[model samples]
Structure formats: C-alpha cells, structure tokens
Target: MFRGLGPEIEHRGEIVVIGLGRFGSSLSRTLVDMGHEVMGVDLDSANVQAHAGVLTHVAEADTTNEQVLRQLGVAEATTVAVCIGADIEASVLTAVALSDLGVPNIWAKAMTEPHGRILSRVGAHNVVFPEAEMGQRVAHLITGGVLEYVALDEDFVLAEMTAPASLVGVPLGESNLRRDHRVTIVCHKPDSGRFTHTDRDTVLSPQDLIVIAGRRKDVDSFGPSRR
Candidate 1:
C-alpha cells in the first residue's frame, strides 16, 4: 500500500518504530525524509492520529503484545527502534517481543544505566541515552576548537577540530600525534576544498579542518588550545 513515498524506499528495507513519543515520532519522520518506508506504532490513539499521513503507516497498538507487533509486520522490518524511554516496563517488554521475533536490529532508548543493562540483556542490539549523549556533545563544542564530536563508544570518539598552530606545515609522519597525544588523524579538509584522507606525508595547513579519533581524554589533550 505504501509505494512512491520516495525513491529510497525502493532499495531500503522497511523500518518499524515503536512508541510514538517525541523521539520515536522524530525518528520516523526523519527516516521517511531519507526515503525509507517507516511504520510508526504507539499505544496512544491521539499520537497515531497526529502522525497520520506524515509517516508511511501509523498504527495505534500496544507493542508489548508480540501478536500485535506481528500483525503489523514488524518482523519483516530490517530495524526496529523502541523509543519508549519513560515507561521502563513497557519498553522492556516491547524490546523482548522484538527480540523473540528475531528482529535483526533492536535499538532501544534507555533512561539510566540499570535500564540500559536490562535492555541489553533482553535482546536490544543497541541501547542509547539521547539526553546524556547530547549533553556530552554540547560540552565538547563549548570547551575547545572541537567543531563536532561523535561518540563511537564510552571512551572513544570521532571529532572534527580546527588545525592547531603547532601542527601547521608539519608532515603527518613527523607530528607524533599518536606518540604525544595518542590520537590519529583520519582525514582533513583544506581551506576551500572537500575532505581528503590523510597519508603519512600529508602536511597540516593552518586553515585545515582535521578529523581525529581516540579516547576522550587523549582527544581533549590534543585540542587546539593545548598548542
């Protein structure tokens, strides 16, 4: 029934989003915009009505019920995200149902450490704390020359930062970044060009924007201010 929503829908598998709260709704809409066929499920009738026509499909159903989820073809979805952060019981139950159905990827929103652990044990492939992650990103942006920060794990991150003065004209092989700060420069963008992968002989320019990956502490130690 859902065809022609976007060209990307033709190639990508359907995505099932449970819980029509702010996070779930936003995720569904963004995925739709990206050309994926998204089915949004929620227990609230009002929420389903509110998102009608905005997503590929909107159903008011209790996702904790495995039968209801199956009726909506959730098992066929390539990925399912349980975005019920407030109700721990409901979130856990929904995640369990998805897992029991052998959903390939189950991403759940967790509110606390214990909650995340429970979700992981119950079959959630990925547990994310949106608020906590956003706070860390904001802290990084305000602290140094960091333009963007993407957390790859609890300790490691991929960060984009302005080239420090000390690095200008220094060859990548001679910079000793791995030895001095324990960070690796993955790529760089010159003053007026697209990003390019770095090589050992690549020299840093004052106006370059570099992307680095390492432990959070090591990345902070290699900040532009430290030069």
Candidate 2:
C-alpha cells in the first residue's frame, strides 16, 4: 500500500518535486512531457488530487519532515525541487531537510532576494524567482518593438522583432547594421516559414521575424518601434 498515487519507489532517474501548486505542478508536468519521471509531493490534498493523473507519482506529505521524505525515497533521488510558495519557513525547512538527506541537486523557488539567499545558504544548489523573472521579462516586451525577449545575462539579450522597411531588399552585409547598431542578426523567419540561420548575405523582407542578439540597449534600439 502506498501513501501516494504511484508506486512507493520509482526508478533512479526520477526527479522529486516537492509542492503541487501552480509552479510545482507546471514544472513537474513539463518534466513529464520531456520524458522524465517526476514524483510530486504536496501538503494539500486538492493539489495532490489535481496532478494525480499527470505526474509519475503524487504524494501528500510534509517534505520538511526528513523521515517522511526518506520514506518516500527522496534521499535516493538525484534532483529535488522545492516549489513551496508563500510559506518561507516551510520552504527553508524543506530545503534544509533535502540538504541533510544529501540529495545531489536541489533547486528551490524563492519569493524575494532575501529568500533566495537564505535558500542558497541552506543548501539549495539553485534558487529561482519565477514570478520576479517573468515580471521583468514582460516589462521588456510591453515597452514595444520586441516580439520576444530573453535575457542571456544582466546586460545581454536575444530578441525577436519584425523587419523594418529600410532593411528589406538590402543584403545584411550592405546595411551597416552591425557597425551602426551594434547587434547581430542571428536568424530570420518568414511569416509563413520556419526560422533559419542568417549570414551577412541574408536579405530581409518586410515584416520577416528577425532574431538579434547583443547588449540589451543595442538590441532594444535596433528593434522597430511599435506602429
């Protein structure tokens, strides 16, 4: 008899995801889609029931209790993620328990910078602020021009934007874009076709989606302004 929805112990490669709330469930589902086995845990029965059919395993357990986690075979997992949101104390305690259990890889979500630092100090190998990161990313896109934006680093970004009229028909080598704009066009996609790599000889067509990479300011300036 198992306390969860699946077998008591899964194969070695499975990931232990603690918390079945929005973030945890979304992550676990994605992992499952990617061909990874995910064992999901949550204190809320509703949350557990919601993901019972999606995850490889679903359990209602207090991950802060090392014994319970051990009983669930979490100690043998190579990776564990603590997606406990709102409750800082429970998140920290769960992280501490995971560390004490010697889980090799620990990823934890934090609501704030201070919370992230605390999680890192308590042995979470990676601390992520999903809400904060998404907010910042949306802020960039809402300013206009860019259709998609990904920050590769604090000052670097890769962005997608529609081709400007001035660049259409002209080969990229003759456009002086890199010299004048300080950004590099990495790829382009026709409105009806898939994206392909770009080179200096590539000619832009009006409204083609171009992916460019450079320092944040440079790429932002090169993007066409919202019409």
Candidate 3:
C-alpha cells in the first residue's frame, strides 16, 4: 500500500527505480519477488500502471524536477536506480536530483564511458553498464559454464564453479575425488543461488555454483579442465 505518486512522501530503506523501460521494469519486478518493497516511476503513465502490483509504489513524474523527487521521498530511500535509456541528459539529471535529495546510494545505468563519467560527476554511487558487465562475466566461461573461477590459499583453495557436463549425472560420493583427485566438494548451489551440500538426494543442475576445496593445481586437473 502506497500513496502520493508525487515526490514529498516519506520513505524507509525502499528501492526506487526510475524509468520503467525493459531492463528497469524487469529489475523492479525481481526486487518485488525477493520480498523487497520497490517504488518505480516513469514519465509515462501507462508504464507505471502496467507494473502496479509488482511494486509497492508507482508514479509517473518528471524526474528532472527536484520537487517531484522530494515528494517521492528520494532522500529517505536507501537506494535508487536511474534507468533512462538513450537519453543521457535525462539520466544525468535524475542522478543529480536523487543525490541532491540526499539518497545515500544511487545506481545509474550508463550507455557509454562518457555517460558513466557524467553520472559520477552528478553523484551516482555506482554506475553499471549492465550489458557490458554481464558480457564480460559470460565470456569468462565460454566453454559451457563449467567452473566459474578458483581462489587459492596456502594449503587449500576455494573453487567457485559449476558442475561440468562430465559430472552432470555423477553423484558426489562416486567421484572418488578426495582419494584420487585429492579434492573435496565443499558445497553445491542450485536453482537461484540457494545451495545445500547435505541434500545429496538432489540432482546437480547446470545452474549450480559448487564450492570445492583442494590444492590449486589438483582442483584444476582433478576435474576435466574444460567443460
């Protein structure tokens, strides 16, 4: 339940998303699903109303106006995401407006390096090039998403990885990894980053981020090098 789509409303640690475009709309919905109360605003009335149930607050306002921002309780929000696409000026203005409102954490979407720099100057706490960042992460595991990455320590290391096709149908104990490969399957993550190493009955999914521990070299060679 929310009131006053206008700016001067009071707020707690709510997440406010500006610009109900494709990416922004999706993120707003996801935050709602995660049990967070989200406030989504856009210049278009249709866009704001379309995502009514998914957000705790929805408004159609001209984000460039400081009064509009003030009424939305931007100063009280814990975080704000500015997602205006194609309009670099609008994005920067909104970022400045939110920061000026005293919102501590401001996240702005950048279309280019220059846009990111401008966002920084305007006081956005974080600037994200969503597509570029995701592309770089995806490129890390081009070979069918086997192991994500490995962290090495003195005697043991933590391997943040996913199950290779080689281990898809294989059970944890059957690997004989501790004896042969000298590695231990520390944890298994499944669907949505929720994990349970004790649930041995649960089959492994390609989506899992299994945490394995062992000597650095052994962890690499112990399993198939590439998925």
TM for every model, in the order presented, reads: 0.88, 0.87, 0.63
lDDT of each structure? 0.85, 0.85, 0.74
Q: List ranges where model 2 is wrong by over 4 Å.
A: 1-12, 224-227
Runs of candidate 1 with Cα error greater than 4 angstroms are 1-12
Q: Count the backbone clashes (under 3 Å) in each candidate.
A: 0, 0, 6
lDDT string, candidate 1, 73-157, tens digits:
9988868889996899999999999999988778888888788888889888778888788888999899768999988878888
Model 2 clash pairs?
A: none
Predicted structure 2, TM vs. truth: 0.87
lDDT value for model 2: 0.85
Summing lDDT over every window of 10 consecutive residues in candidate 1, give the lowest-scoring window. Answer: 1-10
TM-score for candidate 3: 0.63
lDDT of 2 by residue, 1-227 (tens): 00111123334598989988889989999999999999999999999999988898999999999999999999999888899999999999999999999887788998988888888888887778888767767977898777888877557889888887878898999988878889888999987999999887999888699888999888766765324
Clashes of 1: 0
Extract clashing residue pairs from model 3: 7-70, 7-71, 7-72, 8-71, 8-72, 9-71
Encode model 3's per-residue lDDT on 42-81: one tens digit a residue: 9989999898877999999999888988987877787788
Model 3 C-alpha RMSD vs. true structure (Å) is 8.9
